[model samples]
Target: MLFLAEKRGQGQVLPPNTGDTCSNVTMLDSRPFSVLSTSVKSEIRKALAPDILAFAKATGISREDGFDLDKVRLDALQIPVNNKKNKLYIVHWGDMLFGVNGAIWIVEVNSHKGRNLIAPDEGRNRGRSFSGWGMQTLSSENGSYPELMFASKGYYAGGGAKADAQCVRKVGAFYKINTCPAGCDDNLNSR
Candidate 1:
């Protein structure tokens, strides 16, 4: 497990980051409310609002279609990669309505690189129908980048209900999906 140092010299314990690859998969638990100040959280949310709206639009949902920015749930974690000076943000946001849509954004502020894990078009099937999805992070051995698991549940083509999981890791400048159980291919083209 890695620990983050607080301003007062106290250590804040984070989830364990071990192994060459992500394993010991489990359902994602509720994240801590937030370690950031209220103003900082508001700023982050404001910065991401446009992207969220764009996603909804791409999924054929409009502002009048029950898409409310205020109703979205956002969770963020600030992680120090190489040192305390350099940091990365793991942000996850989901709609409060049935968890119909959600995404994970990994941002490296120092590097000016941001990766959106799920594409808007891929989020919904036909402009309205969508799967309920969630994400979990597993710290990598290097402790610089964490492996991610995206799990989703939805109906099958034949009307049968199904659930799926996929594992993703940062390779060079992009995130790639590793072969796993059924339904992992849903977000194959996502960045």
Candidate 2:
């Protein structure tokens, strides 16, 4: 995939927006994912805002219903593919006041195409102690894209808690869920 970087005024170059309709921003950094700067994350959020808004709308959530962009949480991972790399970003938001559980939008950005994976109903009963989503690289062999592990934890009613997880791998142009790990009883002693 070829990404052509566009130069703004002065010397500022925006991220490559490529073939995605969501936004025209792309990352120019060649460093590892651990060193992603704040500015890069901001650009990614801006690029993904439209898609996130659309998902929120489809889920019956609106800006008027406490769905502010400032409240959303963003997480990103860089996946190496051959000599190039693709970026995967997760945008999460919720309105517990309105009985809406947490929602997630995962967007994969590359020079060839852009794809999204959404968990419209996720993180329910995620208590105050519950952290946000987590991602791990399951496999990235022989220059091929990797399988990914996504996990989160939440509480059930009656003071019990559970952990949920899924494994996904890129198939063709999109990602497919491979397996759902058994949820753990975090509060078995409460029984």
Candidate 3:
């Protein structure tokens, strides 16, 4: 549901995003959502197991390890303050989202494995282009955190702007977690 909306393009799907091999990446488009039978969708989801497993195997480890599925406590999945102030991660076992720069692939950010497991760096800056306490504060206020924020910066340890562009170009996913801790304060953000 989330990917579809984000992949629709613009900054999320940034320029120089793809190589010639792959076509445009799409998510949450108007088309895929509409269906006559909810049951059919359910069945399709069920049917996806084998292919998903194959994908996992084809890549290397099984999907179970890659996604960190067991760690996910859907209830406890309250987006953690990994660093950034505002954005939140829609994580399961790992950070999973679709992408396409050369060839589209379902990318996952795994804290379980160090750096080898996830996508190789796109060779951009080690940190974000935008800096300043205000940006960091806004990010925290919004519950958005960089996927692998590094500590080199004052606040954020790992996420960034190019990271976002790269992410969108790689896979049209945008951060979509409501980071406010359920009722303490909902009216803080300026977004």
User: Which lDDT values do the candidates have, in the order given?
Assistant: 0.49, 0.43, 0.23
Worst 10 residues of 2 by lDDT: 22-31
* Per-residue lDDT of model 2, residues 50-143, tens digit only: 6566656667778788788655654343444444455554433433432322444455555555455432233222211112344344455414
Return the TM-score for candidate 3, rounded to 2 decimals: 0.21
Q: What are the candidates' C-alpha RMSDs?
A: 7.2, 12.0, 17.3
- Give the residue spans of candidate 2 off by over 4 A: 1-43, 58-61, 64-73, 83-85, 90-102, 111-132, 141-143, 154-159, 180-191
Prediction 2 TM-score vs. true: 0.48
The candidate scoring highest on lDDT is 1
Per residue, candidate 1 scores C-alpha lDDT tens digits across 27-52 of: 22234325555544555566557677
lDDT of 3 at 190: 11
Please give, for residues 90-132, the per-residue lDDT of candidate 3 as tens digits.
Answer: 2111113212111111222232211111223432211111111
Ranking by lDDT: 1, 2, 3
Q: Quote each prediction's TM-score.
A: 0.54, 0.48, 0.21
Better structure of 2 and 3 per TM-score: 2
| Candidate 1 residue pairs in clash (backbone atoms < 3 Å) | none
lDDT of 1: 0.49
On the 0 to 100 scale, the lDDT of residue 76 in model 3 is 6
